[model samples]
Target: MYLLGLGLVLSLLKYLEVGPVAAWSWWWVLSPFAITALWWAWADATGYTKRKAMEKMDQRKQDRINKHKEALGIQPRKPR
Candidate 1:
């Protein structure tokens, strides 16, 4: 995501002929996009993306349970 943003910024700067970026080759300006693509591909292949999604879901579930417990006047269990 960050790489994508960087790529976009670099592209804009290159397009507008800004400073040193103006002299940079399009390949260099666009490299971050390629890196971002590679990162995504690697993450997907390694299940990193799925793992993060699962962790997020688990956290949301725990937060929901904690909210219910608090509403019932029970303390939420401490996280390990």
Candidate 2:
């Protein structure tokens, strides 16, 4: 995400002819986007994206359960 943002900012700066970025080659200016694409591809291939999504879903599920437990006067489990 940070790489994607950096790519966008650099592209804009290059487009507007701002600072030293304007003098840089298009390849250099556009490298971050390529890097971001590679990063996503690697993450997807390694299942890192799926794992993170599942972790987030688990957290939400736990939070919901805790909220219900609290409403029922049960103490929520402590986080590890």
- Kindly report which residue stretches of model 2 are placed more than 4 angstroms away from their true locations once superposed: none
Q: What is the Cα-based TM-score of model 2?
A: 0.91
Error of 1 at 27 (Å): 1.5
lDDT values, one for every candidate: 0.98, 0.98
TM-score of each candidate structure, all chains considered together: 0.93, 0.91
C-alpha RMSD values across all candidates? 1.0, 1.2
Backbone clash count for every predicted candidate, in the order shown:
0, 0
Per-residue alpha-carbon lDDT of model 2 for 1-80, expressed as tens digits?
A: 99999999999999999999999999999999999999999999999999999999999999999999999999998998
- Residue range 30-79, candidate 1, lDDT tens digits: 99999999999999999999999999999999999999999999999997
Judging by TM-score against the true structure, name the best candidate.
Answer: 1
Error of 2 at 11 (Å): 1.1
